[model samples]
Target: MRIIHVAVIAMLVFAAAYVYRIKMESTVRTEKVLQLHAEVRKEREAIAQLRAEWAKLDAPGRLQGLAERHLKLKPINARQFDQLKNLPERPPSIVNPGDPDPIASMIEKIDPDIITGSLPVPEAAH
Candidate 1:
Protein backbone atom coordinates (compact mmCIF):
# COMPACT_ATOMS: atom_id res chain seq x y z
CA MET A 1 0.00 0.00 0.00
CA ARG A 2 2.85 2.37 0.91
CA ILE A 3 4.60 1.59 -2.35
CA ILE A 4 1.42 2.37 -4.32
CA HIS A 5 1.06 5.77 -2.56
CA VAL A 6 4.75 6.63 -3.25
CA ALA A 7 4.27 5.69 -6.94
CA VAL A 8 1.24 8.01 -7.24
CA ILE A 9 3.20 10.89 -5.66
CA ALA A 10 6.13 10.31 -8.03
CA MET A 11 3.81 10.38 -11.07
CA LEU A 12 2.22 13.62 -9.89
CA VAL A 13 5.65 15.26 -9.42
CA PHE A 14 6.69 14.20 -12.97
CA ALA A 15 3.51 15.65 -14.48
CA ALA A 16 4.02 18.96 -12.65
CA ALA A 17 7.61 19.17 -13.84
CA TYR A 18 6.59 18.56 -17.47
CA VAL A 19 3.96 21.29 -17.33
CA TYR A 20 6.44 23.77 -15.81
CA ARG A 21 9.03 23.02 -18.50
CA ILE A 22 6.53 23.50 -21.31
CA LYS A 23 5.28 26.82 -19.85
CA MET A 24 8.85 28.17 -19.48
CA GLU A 25 9.71 27.19 -23.07
CA SER A 26 6.60 28.92 -24.44
CA THR A 27 7.43 32.14 -22.54
CA VAL A 28 10.98 32.14 -23.90
CA ARG A 29 9.75 31.65 -27.46
CA THR A 30 7.26 34.51 -27.11
CA GLU A 31 10.05 36.82 -25.83
CA LYS A 32 12.28 35.87 -28.74
CA VAL A 33 9.52 36.57 -31.26
CA LEU A 34 8.85 40.01 -29.70
CA GLN A 35 12.55 40.86 -29.82
CA LEU A 36 12.80 39.87 -33.51
CA HIS A 37 9.76 42.02 -34.38
CA ALA A 38 11.29 45.03 -32.58
CA GLU A 39 14.55 44.57 -34.47
CA VAL A 40 12.71 44.44 -37.81
CA ARG A 41 10.83 47.63 -36.99
CA LYS A 42 14.07 49.42 -36.09
CA GLU A 43 15.73 48.34 -39.36
CA ARG A 44 12.72 49.53 -41.38
CA GLU A 45 12.81 52.93 -39.69
CA ALA A 46 16.53 53.24 -40.44
CA ILE A 47 15.99 52.40 -44.12
CA ALA A 48 13.23 55.01 -44.37
CA GLN A 49 15.50 57.64 -42.85
CA LEU A 50 18.31 56.77 -45.28
CA ARG A 51 15.95 57.02 -48.24
CA ALA A 52 14.77 60.49 -47.11
CA GLU A 53 18.38 61.64 -46.75
CA TRP A 54 19.18 60.37 -50.24
CA ALA A 55 16.19 62.28 -51.67
CA LYS A 56 17.38 65.51 -50.02
CA LEU A 57 20.90 65.06 -51.38
CA ASP A 58 19.61 64.49 -54.92
CA ALA A 59 17.42 67.65 -54.90
CA PRO A 60 17.53 69.38 -58.34
CA GLY A 61 18.85 72.76 -57.19
CA ARG A 62 21.77 71.17 -55.33
CA LEU A 63 22.57 69.00 -58.35
CA GLN A 64 22.49 72.09 -60.61
CA GLY A 65 24.86 73.94 -58.31
CA LEU A 66 27.26 71.03 -58.27
CA ALA A 67 27.20 70.81 -62.08
CA GLU A 68 27.83 74.58 -62.44
CA ARG A 69 30.80 74.35 -60.07
CA HIS A 70 32.46 71.33 -61.65
CA LEU A 71 31.25 70.26 -65.11
CA LYS A 72 29.02 72.89 -66.81
CA LEU A 73 31.89 74.68 -68.66
CA LYS A 74 31.48 75.34 -72.44
CA PRO A 75 33.21 77.27 -75.25
CA ILE A 76 31.81 80.69 -76.31
CA ASN A 77 31.79 80.12 -80.12
CA ALA A 78 32.36 77.86 -83.14
CA ARG A 79 35.68 79.66 -83.83
CA GLN A 80 37.35 77.67 -81.04
CA PHE A 81 36.34 74.42 -82.75
CA ASP A 82 37.76 75.71 -86.09
CA GLN A 83 41.06 76.70 -84.40
CA LEU A 84 41.37 73.21 -82.83
CA LYS A 85 40.83 71.53 -86.21
CA ASN A 86 43.52 73.68 -87.82
CA LEU A 87 46.23 72.43 -85.42
CA PRO A 88 48.93 70.22 -87.12
CA GLU A 89 49.33 66.50 -86.30
CA ARG A 90 52.11 65.85 -83.75
CA PRO A 91 55.33 64.25 -85.06
CA PRO A 92 56.31 60.75 -83.71
CA SER A 93 59.58 62.30 -82.44
CA ILE A 94 57.53 64.02 -79.68
CA VAL A 95 56.32 60.77 -78.05
CA ASN A 96 55.27 61.51 -74.46
CA PRO A 97 58.19 60.91 -72.02
CA GLY A 98 55.80 59.78 -69.24
CA ASP A 99 54.28 56.89 -71.28
CA PRO A 100 55.93 53.45 -71.03
CA ASP A 101 56.18 50.94 -73.94
CA PRO A 102 53.65 48.23 -73.12
CA ILE A 103 54.37 46.02 -76.15
CA ALA A 104 58.19 45.82 -75.76
CA SER A 105 59.39 46.23 -72.11
CA MET A 106 56.15 45.30 -70.31
CA ILE A 107 55.79 41.93 -72.09
CA GLU A 108 59.38 40.94 -71.32
CA LYS A 109 59.20 42.04 -67.66
CA ILE A 110 56.14 39.85 -66.81
CA ASP A 111 57.01 37.00 -64.38
CA PRO A 112 56.43 33.55 -65.85
CA ASP A 113 55.07 32.29 -62.49
CA ILE A 114 52.36 34.98 -62.57
CA ILE A 115 51.17 33.84 -66.02
CA THR A 116 51.00 30.26 -64.75
CA GLY A 117 48.99 29.23 -61.60
CA SER A 118 52.20 28.58 -59.61
CA LEU A 119 52.19 32.17 -58.17
CA PRO A 120 49.27 33.63 -56.20
CA VAL A 121 50.51 37.26 -56.25
CA PRO A 122 48.89 40.05 -58.35
CA GLU A 123 51.03 41.65 -61.08
CA ALA A 124 53.50 43.99 -59.38
CA ALA A 125 54.63 47.35 -60.80
CA HIS A 126 57.49 46.90 -63.31
Candidate 2:
Protein backbone atom coordinates (compact mmCIF):
# COMPACT_ATOMS: atom_id res chain seq x y z
CA MET A 1 0.00 0.00 0.00
CA ARG A 2 1.07 3.67 -0.49
CA ILE A 3 2.70 5.42 2.58
CA ILE A 4 0.03 8.17 2.80
CA HIS A 5 -2.80 5.63 2.47
CA VAL A 6 -1.24 3.40 5.24
CA ALA A 7 -0.91 6.47 7.61
CA VAL A 8 -4.53 7.47 6.95
CA ILE A 9 -5.72 3.91 7.66
CA ALA A 10 -3.69 3.82 10.92
CA MET A 11 -5.18 7.19 12.01
CA LEU A 12 -8.73 5.92 11.20
CA VAL A 13 -8.13 2.76 13.26
CA PHE A 14 -6.80 4.84 16.24
CA ALA A 15 -9.79 7.23 16.05
CA ALA A 16 -12.28 4.31 15.94
CA ALA A 17 -10.67 2.58 18.92
CA TYR A 18 -10.66 5.86 20.96
CA VAL A 19 -14.33 6.49 20.11
CA TYR A 20 -15.28 2.93 21.13
CA ARG A 21 -13.39 3.28 24.48
CA ILE A 22 -15.12 6.62 25.18
CA LYS A 23 -18.56 5.07 24.35
CA MET A 24 -17.96 2.13 26.71
CA GLU A 25 -16.78 4.48 29.50
CA SER A 26 -19.84 6.72 29.07
CA THR A 27 -22.17 3.65 29.14
CA VAL A 28 -20.57 2.38 32.40
CA ARG A 29 -20.80 5.88 33.95
CA THR A 30 -24.45 6.21 32.86
CA GLU A 31 -25.31 2.87 34.51
CA LYS A 32 -23.52 3.95 37.72
CA VAL A 33 -25.44 7.30 37.73
CA LEU A 34 -28.72 5.40 37.28
CA GLN A 35 -27.85 3.08 40.21
CA LEU A 36 -26.94 6.07 42.43
CA HIS A 37 -30.21 7.84 41.50
CA ALA A 38 -32.22 4.69 42.39
CA GLU A 39 -30.29 4.37 45.72
CA VAL A 40 -30.98 8.03 46.59
CA ARG A 41 -34.70 7.59 45.80
CA LYS A 42 -34.84 4.45 47.99
CA GLU A 43 -33.04 6.24 50.84
CA ARG A 44 -35.44 9.22 50.58
CA GLU A 45 -38.39 6.82 50.77
CA ALA A 46 -36.87 5.16 53.87
CA ILE A 47 -36.37 8.58 55.47
CA ALA A 48 -40.01 9.49 54.75
CA GLN A 49 -41.18 6.22 56.31
CA LEU A 50 -39.00 6.85 59.39
CA ARG A 51 -40.38 10.40 59.72
CA ALA A 52 -43.96 9.04 59.58
CA GLU A 53 -43.11 6.47 62.25
CA TRP A 54 -41.50 9.19 64.41
CA ALA A 55 -44.58 11.41 64.08
CA LYS A 56 -46.84 8.54 65.16
CA LEU A 57 -44.51 7.67 68.11
CA ASP A 58 -44.13 11.32 69.22
CA ALA A 59 -47.85 12.24 69.19
CA PRO A 60 -48.76 14.08 72.42
CA GLY A 61 -52.07 12.17 72.87
CA ARG A 62 -50.29 8.80 72.48
CA LEU A 63 -47.56 9.83 74.98
CA GLN A 64 -50.22 11.04 77.47
CA GLY A 65 -52.14 7.75 77.17
CA LEU A 66 -48.94 5.72 77.70
CA ALA A 67 -47.99 7.85 80.72
CA GLU A 68 -51.46 7.48 82.25
CA ARG A 69 -51.42 3.69 81.76
CA HIS A 70 -47.79 3.03 82.86
CA LEU A 71 -46.92 5.89 85.31
CA LYS A 72 -50.28 5.91 87.24
CA LEU A 73 -49.59 9.54 88.37
CA LYS A 74 -52.00 11.46 90.62
CA PRO A 75 -53.53 14.92 89.96
CA ILE A 76 -52.04 17.92 91.85
CA ASN A 77 -54.09 20.06 94.37
CA ALA A 78 -54.23 23.90 94.71
CA ARG A 79 -52.73 23.67 98.25
CA GLN A 80 -49.61 21.78 97.00
CA PHE A 81 -47.44 24.98 96.98
CA ASP A 82 -46.42 26.59 100.35
CA GLN A 83 -46.65 30.39 100.98
CA LEU A 84 -43.50 32.62 100.60
CA LYS A 85 -43.51 33.43 104.33
CA ASN A 86 -43.49 29.67 105.21
CA LEU A 87 -40.34 29.06 103.08
CA PRO A 88 -37.02 28.28 104.92
CA GLU A 89 -34.19 30.93 105.02
CA ARG A 90 -31.06 30.50 102.85
CA PRO A 91 -27.96 28.99 104.59
CA PRO A 92 -24.99 31.29 105.51
CA SER A 93 -21.70 31.13 103.48
CA ILE A 94 -18.96 28.89 105.06
CA VAL A 95 -16.23 31.57 104.44
CA ASN A 96 -17.16 35.09 105.65
CA PRO A 97 -16.92 38.09 103.18
CA GLY A 98 -14.15 39.73 105.31
CA ASP A 99 -11.87 36.59 105.29
CA PRO A 100 -9.58 35.50 102.38
CA ASP A 101 -10.70 32.34 100.41
CA PRO A 102 -9.09 29.29 102.15
CA ILE A 103 -10.22 26.83 99.36
CA ALA A 104 -8.52 28.85 96.57
CA SER A 105 -5.18 28.96 98.47
CA MET A 106 -5.30 25.16 99.02
CA ILE A 107 -5.93 24.52 95.28
CA GLU A 108 -2.99 26.81 94.26
CA LYS A 109 -0.50 24.80 96.37
CA ILE A 110 0.61 21.80 94.19
CA ASP A 111 1.49 18.64 96.19
CA PRO A 112 5.15 17.44 95.77
CA ASP A 113 4.13 13.78 96.45
CA ILE A 114 1.91 13.64 93.26
CA ILE A 115 4.21 11.82 90.70
CA THR A 116 3.82 11.29 86.93
CA GLY A 117 6.32 8.29 86.79
CA SER A 118 8.74 10.45 84.76
CA LEU A 119 11.53 13.00 85.30
CA PRO A 120 10.70 15.80 87.82
CA VAL A 121 8.83 18.63 86.12
CA PRO A 122 9.70 22.29 86.94
CA GLU A 123 7.02 24.07 88.99
CA ALA A 124 5.37 27.18 87.44
CA ALA A 125 6.79 30.44 88.90
CA HIS A 126 4.38 32.53 91.06
Deviation of model 2 at 72, angstroms:
2.4
TM-score of 2: 0.72
Predicted candidate 2 versus true structure: per-residue lDDT over 1-126, tens digit per residue: 699999999999999999999999999999999999999999999999999999999999999999999997989999898899998998865545664876765555647678767787888999
| Whole-model lDDT per candidate | 0.84, 0.89
Q: Which stretches of candidate 2 lie over 4 Å from their true place?
A: 94-126
> How much is the lDDT of residue 103 in candidate 1?
58
Best candidate per lDDT, number?
2
Q: What is the TM-score of each candidate against the true structure?
A: 0.57, 0.72
Give the 10-residue window scoring lowest on summed lDDT in candidate 2: 92-101
User: Clashing residue pairs in candidate 1, if any?
Assistant: none
Across residues 1-126, which tens digit of lDDT does each residue of candidate 1 receive?
Answer: 999999999999999999999999999999999999999999999999999999999999999889889996875885666665778996654333565874565566667655566766667889
